[model samples]
Target chain A: MVLELARPRPIWQIMFSTHHTDVGLLYLVFSLLAMFVGGAMAIALRVELFAPGAQLIQDAMTYNRLFTAHGTTMIFLFLLPSAAAVGNYLVPIMVRYKDMAYPKLNAIAFWMIPPAAALVWLGMADFGWYANPPYSVISAPAPAAEMWIFGLKVLGVSSILSSINFVVTILKCKHPDLSLGKVPLLAWSFLTSSIIVLAAMPTFAAALLMLLTDRLGVSGFFNPAVGGDPIAYQHLFWFTFHPEVYVLVIPAIGMMYEIIPRFSRRPIFSHSSGVAAFIILALVSFASWAHHMFATGMSFTEKTVFMVGTLAAVPASAMHVFNFLATMWNGRIKFATPMMFAVGGIALFFAAGAGGVVNTAMPLDFITHDSYWVVGHFHLFVFGTIAFGTIGFVYYLFPYITGRMYNEKWGVVHFILAFVGACITFFTQHILGLFGMPRRIYDYPEIDAWISMNQLVSVGAMIILVGMVIFLGNMIYSMAKGKPANLEDPFGLGGKYYYPFAQRNPQHGEGGY
Target chain B: MAHSNWAEWIYLGVVTALLIYVGAEAWNVERIIDHAPADAEIIIVTGQQWFWTFEHEDGTKEVGELHLKKDHAYKFEVTSIDVNHDFNIPEFVVLMDAIPGRINTVWFSPNEAGEFEIQCREYCGLIHYNMRAKLYVEDV
Candidate 1:
């Protein structure tokens, strides 16, 4: 007389699954556009810094606005969302579903991007992103602050809709053959990312709403003049921003799960171990949010908890890379273009992620807090890993979606240049930060050595720009004129490896990749 | 054997280059390069309208050019007199978040002390540049 415990089922399920293919494509397209906008701001900032004194954006306030817009647009609007797009698109494919469990809801979620983007960006045309302050706002007849408020609200609404859809989908639509225990590796990351978005985005949405109301002269809290604590804004803001970083990387991990094994022509090294890593990260997201506040003079107890918890995440993450490389071991390796990007993505992820280890040192953070070094570390992880993973995902999966092959030579060309460009642009930043070059400075002093490192980084950025344009061209052209796909396993993995684990006993003829 | 060893050699070569670069940077141990000695300590508390408010802590209880002891340590506890502004001093390698409702503290024992400039790194308003304040560290 024993009772059986099982995964819970919901009252209703809808199966118009947003196939990972469509979501992945959307993610790539959106990120490319974001890269364009964020890069435009960076280029303007670079133009100002190219020589001492004024350039295209002359006012110091104007320069401040550009940097803010660049960071906000890239983080909130571009990269993390691109990762979400990856999750939305690929989860079903990994889970053996035809589409997302709730397709109509998925449509509702995807459809929300543009308007939300509009909300996040509405003030840019007429006013600087920070135009609504005690500082110099846009003198234009209309107040753009309201527009900004509206735009962010719209985007938040969309994020919430997507979260609801994803939660319902993963919980219900998994194949009967796949228990929660046996869910695909990508699905594990997808579910966790969805959970983070659900828990975190709401805080951001509520805060932005209060800001909107405050701007409108109605106190929705957070105004000390009206008895609201200003520090509260930071508390809420970082609550969202910290987990927001994880929101960026988790999807890339999912994409690597799909690509690495295929490129290596091997089955996954260990399924259960990878799932555990994903779960550990999901559970750890809450405790680590406070590391961003270590310099804000938070109490020693909170600081100690966050510091220990943050380092804990490092070990959990190590399990993932170990599993990935293990999957590649003893397997036939194809240095195909997509595989190269995946490999490069993992390498740079380590490089950037390794430096992030420094931030966990509270004393170190005290010295290098908010310096250009932090900037460098962030980009290395973000542009290096998340962005690279996305581009790699699009390249690897393009044929399946569009039924055409990319020119392998050009794909390789794009990958090498982009990887090299990322290294040049972001790697030098570590040196600049160590040299005491604080971030958000429109200009550095004559004797400051940051000049050379910055100049080199700019060159790297230019290379990345060129590589990106070429990759964009590759995507457009490949879809238009590349070879038509005729086989299920387009990667040409040998018969012994495709079906997983069959390589162990070769004579039975069950081996596949 | 040929292929497997080739990969290991490649890995070794890459690791060696990285180690060399790190060794060089560690040897460099680059430190702050500039020096200054100023006549006063001008405390900057950031505010937003959404712009920065640079004011004295005593609220009109103090006077001109931010007077201070020469060559001595003068503390600046950046309280966000108003909305958030991240006060960053590149010369001092100091950055503090002046959250609207809370206080952020950063201590800098200025070597060979002097006058330094501070600006808000966080975008607070159209006049973020105007959110600028002057700091003077004496050579005590």
Candidate 2:
């Protein structure tokens, strides 16, 4: 089997294959490609922001386009698809099924990403990721903004289809003896997030269409000039996205679940509570969407309601953090690269959650809204927490996917640089925001605080770029020439484990016992 | 397990109480900020593609600059002539959306006699970053 994976196959064969593993591999590769592309744009933006005025980017419009594309690419192209990649690889195997319930549909879902990504990259829309109107409708450049909408629409449909595949595969294709309660925690994470995608994605899909039509001058759904309310678009967009945040994070948490316990050489501390947290997090995510709109003149009663609604998520998220810490408490811990990333991710998760609490307070919203503080806060979640977990899981799965182990020393180096860089860049932005630097600005008035902090942020971004270079070099070099891994004990932790490939043949091992 | 359950409940209870306290305080702040004094002056602030226009109660219009007397309450009826912009006086934590076809209100009393900056907080267009104005507070 290792040889089979190591051997090169014709491009056409891999492209047309309906196997879940093949599709999963494709999703993983494509998501990594998107990550580097998006990360490049981020570095460009940060470099331009190194000074108060434009240094690398010539104009504000180009900066706008870069950040817009950076945001859209990272969220849709990298984060979501990467989670989907993990789901496709592990869900079927964990459920003791041979392939996804609808294998062709799974393939189709993976295939949709390339064209959607092309549209987003080619158009380079200047509107922000949310594409809020009437700016998106009235003032944004045409064809480019239109392409972004259609691109997102296609991506939305693709994810919906993928969610259906996951739901059916997990629920229907599980072996009869394997009860739903006993299904692996990672599978449960996929189930919860997939259900969320089904519920939350359609609102944004409809809003995107409305925005496109508004731009075409055929509809006035959110065009303030035509008796439409711009706030209505915000309401629709956040309604989908606030929950979409969980959709992006839950899978990473699931990856952590897989990593933390296995690396600690212990069973999960409380399996049931972890499942409960995922469900509660999903439900409460919907309640907090309106919190994003507090500055849009929501009434006192409305603002208070949303503020409390946002706070309601605290305990649920706390449960997961507690679960992880407790799981690692007295267990024999291996400080491997994967474990390091997982532990780092949890610590950052707390910081991100704390920032979120501050943002949710209605009074604090006035101070932080549309400021660099928001930029700092969400990136902590997306980059510090979610990306950390995803990248860690990629390292965890490296041995299984490529039949080779990543260079442990270089992997640790990459983690240290990336973690330190994230801390420097994001934490400084928080202070910068408090110092009155508004977000999405291509230039500032060269205040002392802004200038120094911008320089620090640019330096931090350069560190992360270097770390990413090391990471890519490690993956590519290790794949072709690294030492072969022990199939039974990959990390040299002696324990019984269920390997995905081994599950395909009962003679090799008990299938998902 | 029972002990852990107790700890979890206590943690959640404390969080809930803290959130309630903050919510109530935020509500009070909202009421205080949104409620202008009965004799407060009304300033109709209009935001366009790249500038701000402030019309005083007596129909005195000023573009790119606004003057208010210190220690006097003032209410701003903020709206946009073009797309959606945000009227933000960051130093004072005063912010409201300037949406076309809708007027949103925010009130602040200038306590200090000095000059400050006003900016558009939302992403409106190419020059959204440069969409700024000046505010002058005169001693009463």
Candidate 3:
């Protein structure tokens, strides 16, 4: 099997392959590439922000474009795709299916990303990722914003297609013996999230079209000049995105489920509750969309209702965290790289959730809304918690994909640097927000608190950059030359640690079914 | 198992109850903030591409700087002439969206006499970061 993976097939053949693993590998590599691109932009932004006035970047427009591109790329091209990569690889395998219900559709879904990504990059739309209208419709530069709209539209279609494939594969093609209740937790995450994508994505797709037409002077759906309301666009956008947040994180939670139990060598503490949490989170996500717009002059009753809706998600999220802690309680746990990341992610998830609660309280929202506090809170979720889990899962699957072991010491170093960096950067941003630093700003006055905190935030970002460099180096070097893994017991945790390859592909060398 | 279940129930109940309390308080605060005194002065705040323009009830206009009387309730009818802008006074927690074609209102009484910073919170355009104004709250 190692030889099969090592043997160089033509690049085109790999590209054209309709198999799940090949497409999954493509998703993985592309998303990692997107991460580097987006991370570079973040580092650049941090460098420019190291001081009060601009340092590396020349102008505000460029900075705006950088952040817009950075945000769109990180969410769409990195977080979403990385989760999809994991789902693509594991969902079919966990369901005991030979391949996705529609392999061709999977390949098509992946193929759409590069062109869409190119459009976003080439355009570099300066409007924020939400592309809130009026400015988007009236003031933003032309072809660039138009290009961004088209890019997101295509990407939206791609996600819907991929989601349909996942839904069909898990629900229809699962082995009859493996009932829905018995499906792996990872599959359950994909199942719930994919359902969310199907329901939530179309709203944004329609909004994008409306925005494009408005920009074209064809329609005024969200243009305030033509008897339309800008708030309407925000409603459509957040209705999709508020749920899209869960679509990004649920799979990361699922990855935690996969890692924690195996490393601790215990069955999940409560599978039923985990499943229930995922389902409930999916439902409650839609209710909280308007929480984002509480400061947008929503009615008092409306604001209160959405605040309660936002709070409702807390218990569901807490269920997953508690399940992880309870699973690790009093168990023989190996502090491997994956286990370290899982634990760290849970820690940050707690902080992120606490920040979220504060944000949901309407009076507190007045203080934190659109401030650096919101930036800090969401980044703790997306980058700290979600990215940590996904990166750890990549390490967990390293041996399976490459038939080689990563340098354990280096992996731990990477984890430590990343965790520390995340804490320094995001935690300080929360303080900066309290000191009244608004988000999406290209510059700020040289106030003492702003300058010092901005410097600290930049330094923290640099640390993360160094850690990621080491991570990329470790993966490339280990994949080519590291010691071969023991196929049967990869992590060497004694006595049958749930390696699925042997069961699924009994004929190891004959290539995957 | 029963103990764990009980713990979960108690945790959830506490959370729900706490959320309800917060929500009720928030609603009360919202009402208080939204309610302007019947005789409060009206200031129409207009946000454009990169500056704030204020219109006094007597038709006097000021750009980029607003003068208000301390200890006097002032109601601001905020709107954007161009796009969407968020009128935010972080120190005072006076925030409302200044959207075109719609007048959103926020009211505040300045108890302290000092200079304050008013900035646009929402990302509006290239100069969004520098889209700032000064507020002079003088004792009258």
Candidate 4:
């Protein structure tokens, strides 16, 4: 049977093989493990903030390290790697290629992540993820912080290598018959995201190296004591960090584009518009980085320019959202689990984008800056929107990868719990921010109202944790005992887009350039 | 199943409204920036490890706190002694970075007389969470 033939390769082969599929599987496994590690850190953070005072964490130092680890692990360890895993597994397949252009390079790129992640956690760097100077330069525990920087350097190098491989593979190895116009949105997404990675990662690498040298007393690039500007560091850090948000979200939107059409039994409402949106989003990403530094006392003209640049992205995002809605309209909508998650992701992205609008306006940012409101808005985007889209894609591709159908009942339960839990957790934090609560505090002032709001936020975080537990359980259970799926159209939608990776002419032999 | 495509147009209409709202809000921000109160009381706000010190117009200094007259605009010339810190009074909707060796000025008028907390929003060091200052505004 297909299930038997599609069984996972042996452990040794999986570890050592240069095949893109095997390397991609390893990336997924590592990413899942990193997710749990990062998720545990979140639980710790939530439990500490469950009450007003620090009940669980031993001291402020531990709390600081916990959060830094949490942010670093989630952003670098989990989110980026998981996204790469999805891209690595699917891009070649979608392009009808036998393998990535550089399979050995692909394996090397993935293999670098674990050791780099280990270096970060083992050193337990207390510097926050951005690690802005001169605290990062002078005050942080030097050896530990250096390890974190080095780890990030390694991860950056890995991403750049992977990006090169992706670009080459996508551009050169795609099936000759498949023109650029006919490329799947997911492939297009990966291609665009790869270019972004190529462009953005090196700047961060340069920043990290400068930070390392500054920490080691080798240079004074961001050292205020040596006439270097600390604000300059903010400019540099956010230059990459802000576009990094797009780097994470664009691929997610691409995955949603792939899912919605299949579930709606229609082609994307406007493929050209969707492609244009992706390209515009990428181009606009660079223009908006300075918006993150609005509170850093730049001139009014600078602030207005960055604010406009930031808000300018909304039209492209809105275009994509409208296209999604249009695709869903006038179609036989399937209420399948993937469909539910994809739809849920779209809805949350709109809410998150609305919050983004609030953040983008210069005056409103004064109220929300560095408050729990910013925290809430970002979590809504990353967890509520990006995570939802990625999880849906995972489920949508489950049958193709495993040749088995996941438990429909369990998958539905996972989607509902995740969606509801994300809403309860992140949305409440926005109110807490508006109530004047600051973020990254170990213990807050014991004002009664603030305490109550903090408690509510903590409760919501727990709900999200519970939902994630269900999700993890569902993935493990379904992989083992789930029924064999109908290979061509698992949902029986009888649509042209049912199978995402199906070649147009059913050319079985590999015909990629 | 497919329905009338009215929602797409409605969504686009919403986008148009949002863009307009953004333009209006941006102009409001410009007004706030360009028209800072001329007769505001000036305070030199300095940040250090785990605390803040405020020097009033008449040369009296207070650590970890500031006093102000309600309905009077105040401009804070904020700087840090050692590292980067954000001087943020959440209730007053005022935030600016306090960079070492450079003063960043931000102004606000307290409309209500009450005790407000000032938090260092930027990550400074291990005791960053403990960096706090109180603002007490006197009623007219």
Question: Which number leads on DockQ?
Answer: 3
Model 1 off-target regions past 4 Å?
A: A1-28, A60-65, A125-142, A443-448, A496-513, B1-71, B88-95, B99-103, B111-119, B126-140
Each model's fraction of native contacts: 0.18, 0.67, 0.74, 0.60
Candidate 3 segments whose C-alpha is farther than 4 A from its true place:
A1-4, A503-513, B1-4
Docking level for model 1: incorrect
Measured against the native two-chain assembly using Cα atoms, what DockQ does each of the candidate structures obtain, in the order listed?
0.17, 0.72, 0.73, 0.63
Lowest-sum lDDT 10-residue window in model 3 chain A: A504-513
**CAPRI accuracy category, model 2:** medium
Candidate 2: list runs displaced more than 4 Å.
A1-5, A503-513, B1-4
Question: lDDT of all predictions, in order shown?
Answer: 0.64, 0.89, 0.90, 0.82
- Candidate 2 lDDT over A198-236, as tens digits, reads 999999999999998899999999987789988999998
TM-score of each: 0.80, 0.97, 0.97, 0.95
Specify the poorest-scoring 10-residue window by lDDT in model 4 chain A: A504-513
Candidate 3 lDDT, A12-40, residue by residue in tens: 87688877777888899999999999999
lDDT of 4 by residue, A4-95 (tens): 22444457856887666667667877877888898899889988987866689979889889889998998888878878888877788777
Which ranking of candidates, highest lDDT first?
Answer: 3, 2, 4, 1
Order candidates by DockQ, high to low.
3, 2, 4, 1
DockQ of 4: 0.63
- Candidate 2 local lDDT, residue A37: 100
Per-residue error (Å), model 3, residue A156 = 0.3
On residues B24-49, what C-alpha lDDT tens digit does candidate 2 reach at each position? Answer: 78777767666678898999999999
- What's the DockQ of model 1? 0.17
In candidate 1, residue B118 scores what lDDT? 59
Using alpha carbons, what is the TM-score of model 4?
0.95
